[model samples]
Target: MVQQMVQGSVDKMKAELVAYIDKKFEIAALTSDSSGASNTEETEDSDPITLSMIMLQIAAIFEKFGHYDEIYRTYGIEADAFQDECNEVLDLMRYQVEQVESQLKDFQNRLHIEESGGESAVRHNAEMQEKFEILSKDVQESISQFDQYIDTQLKQFEDMPQLLERLQQELASKQGKSESLVRLQEHKSEMIAKIKAAVEELNLQLPKVVSAQIEKALKD
Candidate 1:
């Protein structure tokens, strides 16, 4: 009965933890999509002011990624601790089961001794045997359930690091792209300013060349 209760509590905790992790992944996906959309919309035709805004947005996205990364790291640590706890529980339960089996064997040995004694001893021994069988079945079921839970938890633990690593890679790629976009925008602005200055210089020299050409034509 105690083992059943403990299993129930562990199952509940597992459900809650899985739900929380799923929600975190969902939020991260949504945030990434939103960031991508914002970048797409901003990168089309950015002026200096717009570029500044993009830079700010990129900074904010980086900050958010950093926060998410920390959360992931914290989650990993918590998961490791939780795994350790589950392992300890499993080990304890296994020990208890072994002890129970030893007690069952001793009881059976006593029952065999009592079998040669009398009818009353035989009746008590039969009752005890039934109770022991029920107890053993319950213990077996609990161990089976525990094994399943451990398998599920192990799979989750195995997948988690991969998921975190993928997210980190994606964020890094986005950051690089954002930085490249900023550099390209800056280069574009510089080119525009240089072209404007060159045009102004040509405009300033055009009249002088035209007036000199007219005077030369008149002399001819």
Candidate 2:
């Protein structure tokens, strides 16, 4: 694309310069054939700019395109490095989410396999959050007083429903954390995509801008 744009700018500007030469000098110093196709050489002729300077100007135009191309390649490398880093972090987060999901599955299996005692022993509804909160606090206190836990040991395990309640609460907490991680990973990926898209847009625009600059230089 850059090649086409540069060639188009050079051809148009060269034609205009040739026409100006033919009109002002009434002679073709820049072209020898009717096709207006010939190589121009340096001469001490009086004009706005020398023929060699025109060739230098064209070389400079090509240099501009090369300069942008180098920067574009660097941008691509930097963007790739950033994406790789984000993927590494995302992989770790995915593993952690998977671990939580696995634990939740284990809790579910344990709940199904371990038969609870008669419902008549404890009448707390497992659906209520308050019941689980009470059980969780009791468990924390039991751990704090582990040395004095003969008194609290029977209290902690007296009801099988308390274990189920604690398991459900833990599962809920893990799921919430995993959901946050999933959202963060998605946002990271979206930002990376946007960055890559911006780089591509810059790549697309560089040639056009360079061509415009080349046209302006040739005109001057």
Candidate 3:
């Protein structure tokens, strides 16, 4: 039994080592290929195997190792252990993807906000002050709503067996993670259509404060 246990450990270690090596190789290859391509015409035919390809190869290797029953049997590795390890790895990969997507969404949100406040100048200080107040209030409300949404998501997904805390940190550091804002960004055209339909509702609801200082400066 001891010998079998030792063998199982060795098999698991071997599989993990191969996976790590593959990852490093892929990173190096991708970096080199991208750098080289940036300096040249870079024909499509000359494309290199990217990080994604490396991940595919890693998956294939794991699959092959999984089918090697003799090694598992020799090492006394239980089927449950194999399943647990695979599930953990899969969950980790999914978390990584989620993090990247979150970051992308954040970048989009910031871009959207900046675009919304373009180069047009407010001519009246009073009007500018009022607009600023309204915008600040709206932004704060959006933030509060997003915080509530994240709390809810955390509560809902917390009990998931495969959830990792590190993944949450990565997602948190992402660029535009405000749930409500991100959702609106995703459905922008639809949201814009809705806004157009309810412009009067918005105008009526928001306060009518003005910034004379800002308006006067713009006029000058």
Predictions ranked by TM-score, top down?
2, 1, 3
Candidate 2 lDDT score at position 205: 56
- lDDT of each residue in 18-130, candidate 1, tens digit only: 66556656654554566667756544433323346446655655665555556666676777788899999999999999999999999999988877687987788898888
List clashing residue pairs in candidate 1. none
- Candidate 2 per-residue lDDT over residues 1-220, each given as its tens digit: 4445555766666676666545545434343433422223322243444578557656766676566566557676776788899999999999999999999999988876654643632444553456556555555554444434334433543654664465456656765887756655665576567557656755565565555544544444
Local accuracy by lDDT, each model = 0.62, 0.59, 0.60
How do the residues 1-220 of candidate 3 rate in per-residue lDDT, one tens digit apiece?
5446555755775777677667666655655667565535443434454668557766765666555545556655666687789999999999999999999999999988866765543345566888778766655665565556546544644543333343455456667668645554455565456546555543443332224333433454
lDDT preference between candidates 2 and 3, better one: 3
Q: How much is the lDDT of residue 214 in candidate 2?
A: 48
lDDT for predicted candidate 1 compared with the true structure: 0.62
- C-alpha displacement of 52 in model 3, angstroms? 56
- Winning model by lDDT: 1
TM-score of each: 0.25, 0.26, 0.22
What is the lDDT for 185 in model 3?
Answer: 49
